[model samples]
Structure formats: C-alpha cells, structure tokens
Target: MTNSTAKEEILGRIRNAQKIAFSGKDLASSAGVVTGTPGEHFAVPRDYERTSDMPREEVISLADERIADYKADVRRCSAEPAEINEAVKKAVADAGAKIVGIPSGLDKAWVSGLDEGKGEIRVDEGLGVRDLDALDAIVTSSAVTCAETGTIFLDGSPACGRRALTLVPDVHICVVPADSVVYGIPESISRLRDADPTVPITMISGPSATSDIELNRVEGVHGPRTLMVIIAG
Candidate 1:
C-alpha cells in the first residue's frame, strides 16, 4: 500500500484499539494499555436536553422573524416543474458561477439549458475532493423546507448527490417546491423520520456564518459563502 494508505490503516487500528479500551475491554494485546484507568470515561455523551428560557410561541415568533429577514429579498412561487429550470438558470446567472451536477443529475435537461459561453457546465459523478475543488457552485433539490425559518433540507438523495457539493462549493443553489415547505422544524421531523434516517440531511438557514469569537460576525468559514434558494413555482 502507499504510504498515506498505510498510515491511515495504522491510524484506524489505533482508533479501534482506543474504542475497545474505552468500552471497558482489555486492550493489552493491541495498544499495550490497561483498562480501568482514572480517565476511563472517554466515551462521549450523546443524549442531552437543551433548556431555553423563551416560551414556545415566543421562540416560534423569533424564528418567524429571522425567517422573514432571510426571505426579505428572496422570492417565492407556486410549486411547478418548470420553475426548477428557471431557478437553476437564475441562481447561476445571479452568482456568475459555472454549473456542475452529480451523476444522476447528468441527464437533466435543466442542466443543458446553462449558457456555455457565460460559464462552464458539466455533468459528472466522479466529483471527488479534487473535482469538487474545481467547481464554482452546486445546484440541488431539497427533500423539504421549513417555512417558519426559511430553512432548507438536503437529504443526499440521488438527485442531491454528495453532501459536500452543497457544502464545499462557494455557493449552493437549492430548489424546493412550495408544497414541500412545512410549517416548522417539528413538522419536518416527521417527514425526515419517514425518509432515510441514515441519510446525512443538512439543515441550512441562510449562508454559513458564525459569531464565536467576541460575537463578531464572519461568513463562509465552515461552509458555503452564499446559499441561494429557489422556490419552485
């Protein structure tokens, strides 16, 4: 195996050994380490409830206001098939970005509608790390949306292929049907549970941003710089 591959294999073995040790198993054979040490509770806690001071309706109102702010310049329309093509074109044109789709997205006639003169358009499934680096933007369809927060959900369906495309690229253009827009996140939970539970669903509200340091705002640090939404009419 190559050096990188061999190193990764060794690292995986070490992680497995650590897991076995942390799970109260004897890992003397693997890592020459003993169990029942003082820092043995290496396991991460998964279940925890968050306490919020704001009441339910107040919280809902807050979310509603935030959604309104995000959707201010954003437009909406009735759910229709034709709007998909229109939205894709509009997002690409607006961003001045080239378009690239995943494997299943290749045959989409909407993709062919892109202007090659203005930007490059390609349909390829082999969008590995390197290929992803070359793309300017990714367009996808959502499984659902939250009208209360103007949030969009991408469940990595075949049409939505590789989650990174929606995340890694500088811009993400997601198309959602108006009918698919639910009242709130709670309403989305039911639909999500019915869909593939294992699918990595990304809930995005506006663009990637954070105010961690001194509460100062910064955008596109962890995800896309711009999140464009197209409400299919």
Candidate 2:
C-alpha cells in the first residue's frame, strides 16, 4: 500500500522467483546456475579454416596490395640479404632520414648500405624515450602480416624491438619477409602463438591517424605518421 511496503513486496517476489528458478538451491551455490566442473575441458567447434587456401605468392601479393591501399608504401625486393639491404637503404634515403633507430638484434646488414655521411644508424638496446624521438625514423622487422586486414604484427622479437621504438618515431620502415605474410587474422594468431605465446604483440593497420568531430583526418597523433613496408620475397 505505501512506498516502503511496495518495495518490500517487490523484493519478496524477486527472492521467491529466484528460488524457484534455481530449483530451491542456494543462489550462491555453483550447482544452482554454474554446473561446469573446475578444470574440465570441453570440445569447442573449430569449423573455420585456420588460414585461407591461397598460395604463398598470392598471399604476399594480396598483402602488398592491401598495404598499399592503407596508404602505406610497399616495396618489393628479392629475398636475398643484399637486395634487402639495398631496399632498406633506399627507403631511408627516400624518407630523408638523417638519423635512424634500429633494434639491437636487427641484422646490421639491413642498414649496411646507408652512407654514414647521409644518415646515422643508432642501434636501440635501451634507448630513452627522448633518444628515440630524436631519431628521424625507426626500422624494424615484422613477425607476421595479415593480408586480409593489411595488418602487421610485432611480437617484440629481437628484430621487432621494444614497442616504444616504433611509437615515438615519425617514420617506420618495417621489413617483412614474404613468407611471413598470412591469409588472415586466424593464421596470424596461430603463427604468432607458435613463435612465442608469452611475448606481447602489436598490430598496425596503418600509420597512426585520427578523425575529429568535423571528420578532419589528422595523422601521427599517437604513433608514426609514415609507414613503409618492404616485402622481401
């Protein structure tokens, strides 16, 4: 009849309904609503294909196309180390990079072609944030790339380096092996897990860009403004 009484009635009804719904068992009991045993394994349906059936060459081509569509530069080079070095050299030269940061374990040969007078190469072992920002660009290797999404995955491997190295630099030149390009996200994840499940993964769709309320697109808000991918096959 009164507000207090009505509230009490509603609460009582809710309790009764819960008891009936739970078949008179305690609501907190695991058996009441949750019945799965601890540590029990259940078979999950994996009807989807782990990866697309496209051939390796086709996958790489699709990845290159998608990467270009994202407005990122894509360069193709022979799989040979020397050619890769030349490609890296050209990418840096085109960016007009005076100072470049590279991961500690990255192949020194990649930057071997860079002339000391034109550009300085700094290996990032444990560089400070400002140190990385001062560099003209950062060069690293990708663990895997997804052709479907035009995404690159970095798992902090020796070649990938720390996350900050990529975030602070204005230009990022990622060297991706053609074989590392996968058909889709599922295949990418599978490959990454097989590589190192515990390592952190960073996925880049494109150079960092954001749209404001008026739909004005601005680039390089949080990460590199320019992304160049060298697909070495």
Candidate 3:
C-alpha cells in the first residue's frame, strides 16, 4: 500500500482506541477493529480542505517566503514573455553559468535573451545523467507549484523535460507561472490529474541537502546544490 494509506490506517487505530476509552465501549474486543489483518483496508475520511480561496497575489507571496526559507533564491517577474526572458537572463548571469540546459517544451521566449555569447543553451533531447552533470545549469518551466509547501512539481511534460534532466544538473532554475501556483498539495495534485501517470512526477521543495548526526548541514548531496526560482505572474 502507499505511504498515505498506511498513515490513515494507523491514525484510524489511534482514534478508535481513544473513542473506546472515552466512551467506555468494548468495541475493540467485540468488533476487532484493532486486530485486523495487516493488509485490511480502513476507510479514511478525507474531508479536509483540498482547495484554496486565497488571492493569487497572496499565494505567490507565500510561495516566495517559503521557498526563500529553504535558502534558495527566489525572484518575481511579470508574466509577459519579455519580462520573463529578462529575469531568466539576469538569473543565469548571476549564477555565472556558462552551459545551460533548456528542456524541450519550454517557451522559447524564456531564453530569447540567452545566446552563445552569454552561454551555451543546450536543448534537452533525452540527455543522460552524465550529459546533464556536465552542464553548468538548467532552466525549465514547472507544471505546478504548491505555495503552502514551497514544492514545485515537474510532471514529465515537454516543458518540464525528463526527471533526470533536473536531477543531475548542478543548478536548477525553475520558472513558475503565478497562476499555476496553488495553495496546497491537494490542489497541486488535482492540477495534474489529467497527465499520464507513467510520466514521472518530481516534487522539489528546495535544493537537495542533508545534515549529519552531528547536525552539520551540507547541500547538493542528492541533487542540484543551487536552486533559483523565477516566479512569473
């Protein structure tokens, strides 16, 4: 079963145990609610809010703050093609990237300002891990983002490219459309319901990092060390 399913089952047991104690009911012995087989399924109530009514501006603002909290650089730009391109160009330059990967399906306008003079814009054509690792950075548009969690979801769309394209790169520059930003994970998942499940779904909260038992922090242990988020609204 999925992790979510396991969690709900465990919580159901806890709640049932609490109810039995509070109400002086012997349901556990009479109904065997807690003695079910390992794979027995328990229905879980999913009545929690799944969508947000927050304004678009607030959603984007909260995303910016949350993403920045992870120590990733966040920048906001107009949704216009020109402005996005300029913001992307500036970010590329700031990162001092000389070899940049532009995934397939990404809008040409986003990289219109980037040329050979600034860096090599390598178009992703099912590149392997080694090929991506050689690049200085990569730029791609995200499928959707959860503002509350600062999580960006890259469905294997042409625009987002293959999951490997972002994973192996040293730096990732993800362009997020403001309207594509949702308030929470449920809404974000709802946005991708129509996509093919076989296609990979990459959930990136921040640049990959971890701390040792000593609590010494390190970055880039698993994936890109630097993450630059460009929010285009």
Candidate 4:
C-alpha cells in the first residue's frame, strides 16, 4: 500500500474508536466522519504519585549528588544564617568575584561577609542587560529544586530577580534551602503552584552547555558557565 493510503486507514480507525467512545455512534456506517465538539472535555486519570518515595534527607542528598554530577559546585552548610553567610562568602572568594550582583530583596546575610571595598555588590533595580553581563557573579535564592532532575526553580520572587539577571551573568550562586528540595518535578510544581501561579518561573538544570555536530562540549553558550549551589538547611 502507498504511504497516503496507510495513513488514511490509521486515522480512520482512530476516528472510529473516538466516535464510539464519545458519541456511542458507529462512524463506519456514516458517509462522513464525526468530529468532536470544540469544548468537549475528557476526564484523564491522574493516579501517579506526585513525588518519589525517597525520604526528605535522601531527596536533599540526591539533589546534591545530581547537581554535582552536572559540574556545578555544591556547598552543604548548617541551617544557621551565619553558616550560610560563610559559605556564600567562600564561594564568591573562590571565584575571585570582584562584582557581585544580587536581587534587591535577597537576604543581606547571604553576602554580608563580603567586603565592599574589595568587591562590589550591586543590588539589581532594573539593571540593563549590559550591566548584568559585566558582573562577575549573581547570587539568588531558589524557590524549589527537584532531586531527580537536579533542577532549580526561580519564580521571580524577591530572592530571584528577573530571569535576565541569572541568564546574563557568567556565574550564578543559588542558595537552596534544604526544605525546598523535593523528590521530583511534580512535587516542585505543586509547591510552586501553591505559592503563586502568575509569577514567572525559570528552571535551571546545570551550567549552560551544548554539544555541536562534532560532539565538542562547550559551556556558557546560553547561560551562566558556573553554577554554585549552596544547600543550606
């Protein structure tokens, strides 16, 4: 049979089944095909679990492991604000960051240890794309992270500035709370949906890397080249 004949036969079978299921009518006897109503709705079964069965601690550990496997730096620290500050400071210092950009509403304590005289800290207040591109690094807090995918979600919250800030910078230092690390994408989306549905969300899996036709791996082609995740309890 020709390709067009085979295609028509498959489509005819699908239309016949759908007509039988939805309208209880046999389209085989009809001269013309039956079409579905534009606004018709089908009840889809959502029986799958929203998250994995891993424990909370295991989820966090898995997130760290997966993120590290992507060549992103992971810093585990205590729940204390002071400890988070120290970790952030060290990350910036290790990067030799001279100009750090942050969202206006980011917690000051995260980078409180940085010396202004030695390094410049710019709070983002509608900074142009060019300004963000010149910065050495940008630090922000993540809304949620998926352990299975090693994905971080930023919902343009006070902690997460506009998407441009994270995308334009060479390096990004994301501070993810232990509690925000979930087992999978469904759990992450559920948590974010409860928070706010209108806010823009940006998901980051790892440093921006792409392989060309030659399979040459190149980093930082689209987004930040370095991703430093601080998993603070």
Give one digit per residue, the lDDT tens place, for model 3 in 1-233: 99999999999999988987899876766865555556888776689999878888899999999999898999999999999999999999998998999887999989985875756888999787788888999999998999899999999898998888888988999999998999998899999997779997999989999999999999999899999999998
Q: Which ten residues in a row have the lowest lDDT in candidate 1?
A: 48-57
lDDT of 2 by residue, 95-143 (tens): 9898999999898888895657766888998999889989999889999
* TM-score on alpha carbons, each prediction: 0.64, 0.83, 0.81, 0.83
In terms of lDDT, the best-performing candidate is: 3
Model 1 agreement with the true structure over 10-99: per-residue lDDT tens digits:
999999978887999655646765344565666555354323344444544444455456632254444555566766777788887865
Minimum summed lDDT over a 10-residue window in model 2 is located at: 27-36
lDDT of model 2 at residue 212?
Answer: 100
Model 4: pairs clashing at backbone N, Cα or C within 3 Å? none
Alpha-carbon runs more than 4 Å astray in model 2: 1-39, 194-198
**Prediction 3 global C-alpha lDDT:** 0.90
Error in Å for residue 192 of model 2: 1.0
lDDT of each: 0.66, 0.89, 0.90, 0.89
lDDT of 4 at 135: 96
